[model samples]
Target: MKVYNYARIIYYRSPLLVQILAIAFSLIIIFGTLLHFIEPDTFPTLFDGVWWALVSVSTVGYGDYVPTSVVGRIVAMLLILLGTGFITAYFASISGIAATNQQLFLKGETAYKGNEQIIIVGWNERTKGTIDELLTKTPPVKIVLIDASLKENPYASKGVHFIKGDATRDDVIQKANIQAASMVLITADQSKDEVAADMQTVLTILAVKGLKENVYCIAEILTSHQLANAKRAGADQIVETNLLSSFVMINNVLSHGTSPSLLNLLKEVKDSKVCLQEAPTALIGATFLDVTHEMLQNESSLILGIKRGASTYVNPPTSFKIEEHDLLIAIIH
Candidate 1:
């Protein structure tokens, strides 16, 4: 029973190509041996029978060795019928398997072995647009997308890995190698109710924070009331996308063209876009105006505000001094 189990394991583990080649070789040897015995008088050597079998199976009859006996001819005909078909089918199967494996690999079904990667959890209408923005605007970075709803990776792109699993699970978070990830984004599950979706996001944030405390987490909240819960769950930043959208739409209705300019500021074009970057160590004591002037001269950046602690001060007075852990909100071209 143990030996039978071991044989089954080996059979299952062996690649299709190896199995096909083994079967084809065994059939060739069996037919060749049979032909040798069928016409030993005409076929002087067993090697001659093998040579005829090989050529006949491959459909490349050189006519160097011909079977004379009726039984030998029948064997040859059998080889041509079975062997040729088997070989053709084997090659076709191999090609198909290779193509499928390649597709799976591209779809991120395979395990990822990347470090300092960005992991985006959940997929929704906004997911693809966010991914596109990151790919176009940010520096070259590997992104691993995690979602249980997706059948396969939607992007199938370079520098992107997909893991099909619930982000709220610790095992799934670990599979994405969240500990080594630079950042994690938990998008709202739009399919669920406002409260339910936010709770799901909070759960995922907790799972990720439990695994890696220092990793930056940005979660999308559907309702304003869930912001506190998300923050308590270890989300470094919470975005109320629905509220922001409402604000933008209302502002556009009140004053047209204002929203477009605001939207354009976020778009990546002419290498100019708004970004929130950490303040350099050298700019710790510099005033806002001084840093702004220096950035224009050195980095070609326009200092818009400082994100210090949990507060954002846009277009602060020039008297405001750069803090120790301030994030510079600026536009660069």
Candidate 2:
């Protein structure tokens, strides 16, 4: 008598199809052995008995080999009935696994592995402008957006990624690759207060900075009062949206239709009409007056501000000397 332990093998691997296959195989093998024992000389060898078992269970009934005894025939009937359910279940499990894998591949969720992208926290009306401006100004920059309210991402940019969650949480920030991010832009949610929004932004900034101290953080604030608090929270820069709006409104009132022209001039990109350029190290020792002529002549640019190391010398006159590592924001034509 050959002993085959099907239950033990099925227990360790335990899948629906595997369990069915084990049960069916066990039934066929046990019945074939029993047939051999019942009619000792009737059944040839173990191999022939297994072949007969397979044929009987599958309902092929080759007729070349047969179990003539009543007991053997009874076992054969049981094997045939059991094999039907096993075979059906086996194929069903296979179809299920295939369908699941296909769905996973279609969603593109399995291949999310990359680094050094900008992460934008929160989504609002400003998000549209932020995305548009970033896309226009910076080429080939990858952005990961984190927001809880967004049900579906409306924009379909190639390199943009979206994570649905609260950005204030550490795990959520990590999902957006906050540690490896080149910059983190925190925009206030439209429905929240300026202080509350700023608090959230500050917390995100602090969390990111805790993970990666070198990470650059920029936050948008609705009020000027939150600017100092945001700065204290390790934000590299704070953009006061109200201040910008007021400046634009004032410009429109003062210059009438000329405000549009001024805006166009400030934001011009192609043909180097008006450009902002960082100061080269070689020009650091020179005075503003020395670079003024060169800037106006061939460069066709005007020096608007001198960034000396960490300090900004805005609208510095011709007498202001340029310091080492100073960035000169200029207007070129």
Candidate 3:
């Protein structure tokens, strides 16, 4: 049979355990002094001192050893008062440490880096849908999600990584690798004010832009009023859910019947149908008309818009010329 290691157990238990032991030892010293004065013959021997100290400190008060003298009894009262308080505090500290360590291990500590990856800031109600869509539509794309409330892995996606921290802080942004990220998406927190959400989004955009001026950033704002504010902060794209909802509602009213084709066109990959494809750079120097005509001839995709440097030209006329570094957003067959 193997004996358990007490030293190892004590080392890992808690820092306060040592202090508790000290308090108990001090009380034993006081009581031993009293016993010596009252009756030197009955005073605890070395082994008795150790045994009695352990039993009494553990609250296992045995009646075998009794204090008869008035001074000895007074010393016992002092031990009762101080020892109980120290033991309670030590247990509380141990509990707190255990809880903190459990939380960190569950959430993980790996930071994000590299390029062609998506960074999501601020988790909210729409986050689940957004994550599901990104995973289903864009396979093998790495994603790093940053939020303060996240204490564990929220989803089981292979490419999703969670970072437990405040998204507004620059350190958190750097941890998420904002500089090398292909796209940064700021989800609006419904619990916060439209202005406050926009402010947070703008601050994140500024941080990413300051680090890497070419990183693409998309911010979701609650209202149209915040659109200009987000744009001014260096966001390449601003999405207003309210505006999109209104457009859908208006279209449904105008045509006595809702067009499934129109709805399908509006539906993003989140709906599990349309997938956004990044057109190859080989199409550079090609005319918009030629590209559209070829797409129609090949029955491959519908060219929707062209992104130049930091600007996006939506529904550009046929004569528009495509330049290098232009990202063409289209629906894949």
Local distance difference test values of all predictions, in order: 0.85, 0.73, 0.71
Candidate 3 per-residue C-alpha lDDT over 248-315 given as tens digits, one digit per residue, 9 for 90 to 100: 77888897556575666567533433434555566667789887777656756778788776787888
| TM-scores of all candidate predictions against the true structure | 0.72, 0.63, 0.54
Give the higher-lDDT candidate: 2 or 3.
2
The regions of model 3 sitting more than 4 angstroms off are 1-105, 108-110, 113-116, 137-139, 156-159, 256-262, 266-293, 304-329
lDDT of 2 by residue, 1-333 (tens): 123466566466797667777777877787777777777677877767777887876767889877778887787777778765676677778899888755543332222246778888888888877776667654577778777787655454354677777777777777766666888888887778777877777787788787778888888888777778788888988888888889888888987886787678656744354444766666777778777766777667877777766677777777888776667777666
Quantify how close model 1 is to the true structure by its C-alpha RMSD in Å: 4.7
Residue 130 shift from truth in candidate 2, angstroms? 2.9
Model 3, residue 115: distance off in Å is 5.6
Output the lDDT of residue 151, model 3.
68
Q: Write the per-residue lDDT of candidate 1 for residues 1-333, one digit (tens) a residue.
A: 999899778877898877776677767888888888898876678787787788888888898878887888988888888888778878888899889877876555676778988899988878887787778755677889998888877777556789888899888888898878999989999789989999999899999999999999999999888898899999988888999999899998999878888878555444677889988899899999999998889998888899988799999999899988899998888
RMSD (Cα, Å) of model 3 = 10.7
Clashing pairs in 2: 273-332, 273-333, 274-332, 275-332
